[model samples]
Target: MTTAKETVAPSMLAADPLTDSVDWLLSKLGKHIVMAAPLGLGKPNRLLNAVYRRVAADPSLKLQLCTALSLDPPTGSSSIEKRFLGPFAERHFGKDYPRLDYTVAQRRGELPPNIVVEEFYVQSGAYLGARQAQRSYNSLNYTHVARAVASFRVRVLVQKVAREPGGTRLSLSCNPDLTFDLLTETEALGLPRPLLLAEVDPLLPYIGGTASVDPAFFDRVIDLPGPTPKLFALPREPVTDADFAIGLYASVLVKDGGTLQIGIGSLSDALCHALILRHTRNADYLQMLEALSPGLATCDLVQAQGGTGPFIQGLYGASEMVNDGFRSLHEAGILRRRVVDDIAVMQRLNSGNA
Candidate 1:
């Protein structure tokens, strides 16, 4: 009596050859497919490359590449910023993801009439602000991925992940954020049960929290044997003195043991650093705060809620991105709180009654 998980695991393990698994999945899928975006180290590059090859062979198949943050090779523009960053990006990324097939075809206006790309977010490059990209972009919220999936009748879902060697469980790695939502919506709508394909690359980091999946969830699995795409790295912006002061002042407003939802970029980095300083170097942090806001340190709110004291319970990171700054705080033993997404639970936690 084999359970679904047992059945699926053995079948996936038996489908060893990458091309065989890919061809099998492709045969099961409809002409239209939706893929998760961003060249996270976990992205199924080999599977995606195979899909592009298939699309190339079959000119009549309308394969729409729907996703966000499609990465591009750095442009060798004459602008000073481009001139400075271009070589650095080349040195770092090399020819790893030289070009995504659809991106290249779209840019060259050479896409077969049946192939198109729809992106919700574009890379922050010269092309991003251009009229064409702005017009073509979907401007859909991340929450609406399921809606888009149903609307587009997306018949296949391909995701990449980290697999425990010889284990049936898989980690969504960097993108569990949207995978669950998309899966739920697809199921709820009773859309044609899309073929679920998971690609495992050994190089992906196994991140916890809502990021894991079981073998039963995927219809097929392919193990890519090669160098995985390098993790996309964002250069840290230097924090200005004024920015530091502002961050110091802002840090005193957040109560200890509270949840934080921060966006990525320099300001968020500065705030995290300031919070670390307040927790570890109370006297110096107080001195800086006093100098910046005069009497802010002596305020009742600051006295009751905020203090130049080390976090005994630590803070929770509930940001859209668990970027390098969050990783830094985690390493420093600061961001250790975990908050669930239930409204009632959050209400109790906020009221300090949980």
Candidate 2:
């Protein structure tokens, strides 16, 4: 374990497989470990479970998970739902997708007393009856999670990342939500930089905007030594009449040359579908709009704030979370407006200067 007093050149740091390095990590970080992981898809399940196992074996070793959205395969409760979801989960997650040890233990009411899991966000209704989960829940706003996690004085930071074949850069892929901010916040708190471990998976898409980072960012970039485990994926839900109606209504409120921020769900899918239709088939969209509500087409708010027309100038994505809806919008040529954080550059572009 590299300490605050030591210096190791960042780029030259070598990765060791977790199977052989868990003991090494424990030896380095000591038993009183405060670890951080990214929410949602960025968690490195195998790496985390290895550490969790260490604490479970020895009560003297203390472990506190400072993270959110600990994912588990969708195993339905009722017999009927289970029957339907069993095969589905297997198909998406494969037979050997490593389960988060804490999720399983918590749900089964067998979590070790020495291990504490503090999550600021969780899957909807995932822990309604799990007393341990409820007691350990940390209720913090999403925007403030970085600060809260930093306050834990995280000793290790483990997350999944994307890599281009034979390429040097690693991208946060599905989750860049809080990792960067956490680093900044940790520094602001006058704490040592956490031990950064990057888990590489082939399934993660190589996304560019604000997601890409240099190799030096990580202390080690490790991958599962054998056949790679499948990343957890949720099947897309079918759109319904109510979803379409809400989507159409929401579509009219989106200005053509504005920005958009949407999350994954049937409603967001429907909205993206409606936006594509508004661009590709304007006449049919108008017909549906009139059928849904004749007055909505003439609403003063809609008229001024937005328009029921194709997006010629396109829209920009200003969201922290990225999903398939944004991908579909980009494919349809409606999500083409790129943005930059530089104020002067934006002003120059807006003023039509080279």
Candidate 3:
């Protein structure tokens, strides 16, 4: 039987950027056992260099490093640039230290060069307690992910975890709601949550999620006042006249003060800008009640006035990446949750529910 090495270090340095932390990792665990790091928000290249320097100097400690570099599918660099240039950068220093690569969630239709691009799909026997685990599998690729995780014994280390309805998944926030969502998906796939939550100092509260979960779920909780892997808020691109033309149509359906949930895209931004323009120019943008009586038979007049509906009390975003424009709407109190799940409810919420 092969003896497991004593004191294995699964360094998740990608989540946070701290030199002392990296140095401590080097001193204790050396540089060989580190796997992948999340490069969305930190000085990842710096960490990689430090790891390389250590590994290059000591022939006995050649390590394999995995990285999940951020790539925007819509308008960012193409797949060829990402894959070809991405791995080339790390391996360019020569055989002293080789490059380790992998792909993360990317937009559809992009074919990355050199590196293996993972596909998105639902797995079998992964529907948690649903009737049929193999029913209408959305994508066969995600199922492969489940198979790999089960086979490879992958471990996910993070600052927090949550007990979702489907199962527990590592959570990067205090938000139980978000935890529930991630866990539900994993549980459906029959995969145990591979999260090592509350194992590190300095917990970070992600801005997007509900931000509430039980403290007992954490193994170790330390207070550190800094954002972990600070991500740039998704950028808002400039809109064109064609964009405005589309926005006007979408805007015509919006209720004046009703809650709205806009999906991600140029159309959403245009709609927002158009709404602001109407409110600024027409002054008839705010909520107005019927002259019958105060709060008697309240109907969203804003909707009638080419604004959003009144009963649109709240908005809940179901988008994958929360961008700046979405954040702006939330901050402006235009986004809220709606309990109704009907077409009327949706149409009433946004001027153009379709």
Candidate 4:
């Protein structure tokens, strides 16, 4: 078994210029290439663009790009809401992602006849509601990414990450979600390990967890200096009074020393905020709770598991995406509990004898 340290060591040769990397990848191309998507913040845009150029140069070379959540800049829309959001989205996210090659080709109805772009999770927008996207959409669950790649006969896998400063090992900072699983699946099936490519950027934060990959795993490495592409920050949604009331109700059921698995968005934010308020501003929080639903604060379940008192043991976060809300909760000293993975230890903890 490969140890963590061995698996995260820098062992591959680096390509200094973008062209060298592109040429290396192009030479090993198969009919299909699977790329990191939706989670496109960590995607290798330069290398993919180079692939697009190659496809443009050769009309008969059929290449299927399989991935999900291909984010595109907002184009004009007819609906009033879209009209307002379109310009706002463009003003913020347009220049950063700049005419993503496949999206542009898809929008202009000029994708090469042989080059097919398939997205499992469509970006939610007026653009996706159009005829072309709807016609080309391949609906699938996120868990089925490996199966999709296998079905498409994908022989090349490419993703982006942060290189350990002055090292070659890459950190899948924002998207260790699927790449590891994809690699595992391909390996288990007795398939030749797909040609792995890593585009190393300097700007991505080297987050912890199962996010590191050895340079040996990658067939080629491209070092692109300067700022990496900015991620599409899902703007925090505004919280309403009703939303806060619901959050207050939900917060009372959560055990003080339990784990949290909150997702991204306004509802999650409201819930976390309510929990923090319940801990720090208990009197005010209880008053609001009383006004929203009298006697809820006095329930036996609430009395046992919830309270206005500050967290003594804190809560552990075990979420897929540790969003800004979790960061805030950490800052407020509420998310400090750490869980271990041993069954015997867990039993001891549950029995309050650890």
Highest-scoring model, TM-score: 2
Identify the superior model by lDDT, candidate 2 or candidate 3. 2
Off by over 4 Å in 2: 1-16, 76-84, 351-354
Q: Residue 346 deviation, candidate 2, in Å?
A: 2.6
Clashes of each: 0, 0, 27, 0
lDDT of 3 by residue, 285-319 (tens): 32221222343223355235544333234445554
Off-target runs (Cα >4 Å) in candidate 1 are: 1-22, 34-42, 78-87, 108-110, 126-132, 298-313, 341-354
**Candidate 1: worst-modelled 10 consecutive residues by lDDT:** 1-10
Candidate with top lDDT is: 2
Tens-place lDDT per residue, model 2, 24-108, is 5677688788889988788888889988987899998999898888889888879999999989888898989898999999887
Model 4 stretches astray by more than 4 angstroms: 1-19, 30-38, 77-91, 94-96, 107-110, 126-128, 147-151, 166-168, 225-229, 300-310, 352-354
lDDT of 1: 0.68
**Candidate 4 residue-wise lDDT, 1-354, digit = tens:** 112122221234344355555455555664444443435565566677877777677875666777766656566546887878876886676445545687777766777777777777766663443555566778887678776666555677767777777665668876686777776777777676666667676767876556876777666666655455565555567988778777888888777788888877778888999989977888988888888889988878889876656688889998757689899999889998767889999788767799
> Candidate 2 or 4, higher TM-score?
2
- Superposition error at 78 for model 4 (Å): 7.7
Better of 1 and 2 by lDDT: 2
10 residues in a row with least lDDT, candidate 3: 1-10
